[model samples]
Target chain A: MLKKLLEFLILWIIWTLLTWSLALPDILAGVVVSAIAVLLFSDLFPAEIGRLLHPRRLFWGLVYLPVFFWQVVKSNFDVAYRVFHPTMPIRPGIVKVRTSLRSEIARTFLANSITLTPGTLTVDCVDDHLYIHWINIISEDPEEETRLIVEKFEKYLRKIFD
Target chain B: MSNLVIIFLSIGLFFNFAGCLGLIRFPDIYNRLQASTKCVTLGTIFILLAVVIHFGWNSISLKAILCVVFILLTSPTAAHAIARGSHRAGFPLWEGSIMDRYREDQEGETESAN
Candidate 1:
């Protein structure tokens, strides 16, 4: 109950901040509403609430942003090149590759990372394997491509949210 | 000079630009997401930090702090949701990944149930 109250207070504080409105009455009302919300919803998903407040996981994310930023820039230019090439030297195919990670959290992070990049879309992931749709085929070397994708993103996710 | 603010903004801009570049160059979905999530988060925080400083130790600063907290809260969850949804819809991982313990467990359960 104490933890729930703390969480509620934090969230209300956050809500008040995001609104950029610091009026005392609003803050009070916000706290009240959030408290009610917690009361009504606590039994529905207690585990998720616990996970949401996981500090260790969030701390790692603080370390992750810089690395991820660098990768984004490099891919943008490459994606642009593929799109602009008039002859359309793009190869469209879905390739499947396995993952070493076990948890749904890790695997899901991997999938979203792939899709967030420009030229590739995460078409699927079954049994720890990813099905990716690629617009530009830099090479037909499936092993090399698979290695590059997961090596590029999954490694960092392990650090950030593991 | 308020150099801290300037420096922070510069770093923030650099990260945001880097994220955009990664989105362009990466070979597939996984890599691009990494770039965006990392760069944007970092860039956005720095920007928010700047806002806080600019606004001074006032209500705006308080709000800025809140923004950071909320962002710290939701961004990963959003990314996770998207990734899981994609995977469930049928995306594949790379070949070198030797073990998929999650899949193994799922299969194991189904097999035993049957």
Candidate 2:
């Protein structure tokens, strides 16, 4: 409990710094208010007692981030080409794909990862299957398209978080 | 200006650029969201640290505190809503995925329904 409270203070202070404000006494008061809010949130939301911490897999996780970065750089042009071309060669549709990451956090991350980019969006995730909408799926094969996105993310997430 | 703070700020700016780059580069909505959220969250935290140092009072300090507070509160919520919204639209997970627990549960429920 004490540790959680300390985290609350640390979190509040971080918030105070973010805005670059100068109000002293008020900010202090705000911290208490925010702390209370966090406390209430904890009370309201019962956390599942599970092995929340994943075992150390630091090397792959760290390596994976750069891999993700490269994909982001490469994909930007692919998307831009489709969007800006005088005669847009676009093949947009919804496709279903599967993933290896079963943990909710990894799955959620994978889902969010897809949505963050330009042309494709994760339409639905029921269990392990993810439905994605591509503004331009380059190949006609849904399997290939889903493989491209999932393999990149899941491989890293499995290493990083699970 | 503190050298440490300057370093953090420079790194934060780099993250900001990276996040925007992800927004531009990724092939779909979900991937872009991942890059922006992770990068911006990290960048904003660093930027906030610089601000906290620049201001030492209570009230403004409080607002800075509030900024972080609100960010923590909203970021995941916003992301969750977007993901669920997309999922309902019928997007699929990638291939080589080994599980579909949700499908099993849903199927179980529907079978029981019958």
Best by TM-score: 2
**lDDT, candidates in the order shown:** 0.61, 0.60
| Top candidate by DockQ | 1
Cα lDDT of model 1 overall? 0.61
Superpose all Cα atoms of candidate 1 onto the true structure and report the RMSD in Å to 1 decimal: 7.9
Query: DockQ, in order, for the candidates?
Result: 0.12, 0.11
Docking class of 2: incorrect
Tens digits of lDDT, candidate 2, B7-27: 868866776676677577655
At residue A66, give the lDDT of candidate 1. 65
For each candidate in turn, the TM-score is 0.52, 0.55
lDDT of 1 by residue, B31-101 (tens): 45545665676578888999888778988888777777666546655654564465455555444333333
Best by lDDT: 1
